[model samples]
Target: MGRSRGGYSTKIHVSVDGLGNPLELRITGGEKSDITQGEELIEGWQRKDTKVIGDKGYDADKLIEKIGEAQAVIPPKRNRKTQRHYDKHLYKERHLIECFFHKLKQYRHLFSRFDKLARNFLSFLYLVSALFWLK
Candidate 1:
């Protein structure tokens, strides 16, 4: 959890498959940048034909290189000196991940952060993810 103006908050980082099923999930303090956790979320994802779609926050030289053979559909940030092009059609698929979040938030306890311990929260997250797979 991270202390902020509103109070303590946690950030949930998730990686979803092409079908919008979650592949991995990580929880970090609200203050942590998406880039800091991007690498871990993509760790061991080396399928050459796979496309890694992400928002501009995941745009970084190191992370891109880590993606290696996999196609990266991340749009370059506006401030970058050389803007890189990405597949707009594929990037549209990113909404699937957003939809997953919407579904997750429908669970009141998860949305309200009822669990004080991060471990407990993470455990519940895993359970919810499993339930999603079951459905």
Candidate 2:
């Protein structure tokens, strides 16, 4: 989602790997924090073999520490009170996730939240991802 007169718009909670491929997508209330949705987005098998990269917004101590075998490559937020170590070079590669979102939203079905149910919306997003692979 993009910025608007109403303030920052909707946040698409996309979970991507170190290479920036979308593994999961979740729609939340526009005001939600990226870190708040991180765990739910990265749970189970998909997270078993990956190094997750995200910006400072996902700098929660809990999430940074607990992603199963996957490493949370998120840097510490500016105001964080502790000395946290993160891989800067790895974080740079995170732009792939951004590009994925940009491409994902190009599909008309995913540009807006038209479905009333979360499952339906998720299915549309998956369809959008599938269509991208078809190109």
Candidate 3:
């Protein structure tokens, strides 16, 4: 968990397939950089056709290189001097992960983080995710 003016918070990173089904999920402190978690999220990804699409927050050279065979569609950071090529068409699909977060917020406790322990919070997250998967 991370502390900011809003108090303790967390960031949930997730990946989805072309169909918008989640392939991976990671929970990190709200203060943690999204680019830092980017590589870990694809650690064991085996699908060659997989392409990771993320917003500017996830823009990092290490992540782009780490993705290896799988494509990365992260937009360059505003501070970058030279822009990198990204698939605009595919990057638009990154909204699927946003929609997932919107659905996750429906669970009141999750939205507020009433659970003190990260493990417990993660358990509920998985449970809620399972519900989404069932749908």
Candidate 4:
């Protein structure tokens, strides 16, 4: 369980294409570090021209080195001494993925973890995702 000032929550990590279509998803306790699943999210989906874009939470040396080998647009954390360069223009496109999350939350059942079991929650998530794709 992950708890913060807001109380217990979970983090839904996602990988999306340039078009804003979700390619993959993973759920973890909110306390979990985003970098832990960063590499796995791009595993087999990586391509030569693929550029992985992420927020400051995904900033890490190993993840940067791993995805940077292909093309990474991840911004360095503000606290980093050696700041990394990223294309602000490309990073702006990250809003597409954020919008997708907002859309998913539109479904009342998904707005909260009504289903206690992870399997049940994930199943509903897949169903909701399919609906999004159909739209």
Clashes of each: 0, 0, 0, 0
Candidate 1 lDDT, tens digit per residue, 70-100? 9999999999998888999989999989999
* C-alpha-based local distance difference test score of model 4: 0.82
Question: In model 3, where do residues sit more than 4 Å from their true spots?
Answer: none
RMSD of candidates 1 onward, in order = 1.0, 3.8, 1.5, 1.8
Q: Write the per-residue lDDT of candidate 2 for residues 1-135, one digit (tens) a residue.
A: 334567545677887654556677777656667778887876773355577777887788788667757766788878878968988887888888878988876776667666656677678888877666666
Local lDDT at 105 for model 3: 83
With candidate 1 superimposed using the best TM-score fit, by how many Å does residue 74's alpha carbon deviate from the native? Answer: 0.7
- Candidate 4 on 1-135: residue-level lDDT in tens? 356788757788889877777889888878889999998897875566888889998999888777745778889999999998889998988998899898888988877777766677778888888887777
> So what's the TM-score on candidate 1?
0.95
The sequence of per-residue lDDT tens digits that candidate 3 reaches over residues 9-128 is 888888776666777878888888888788778887635788878889888888888888888888898899889999888888878888888888899999989987888888888888
Model 4 residue pairs with clashes: none
Better of 1 and 3 by lDDT: 1
For each candidate, what is the lDDT? 0.91, 0.72, 0.82, 0.82
- Regions more than 4 Å wrong, model 2: 1-9, 45-49, 112-121
Q: Candidate 3, after superposition: displacement of residue 23 in Å?
A: 2.4
Question: What TM-score goes with each of the models?
Answer: 0.95, 0.76, 0.90, 0.90
TM-score of 3: 0.90
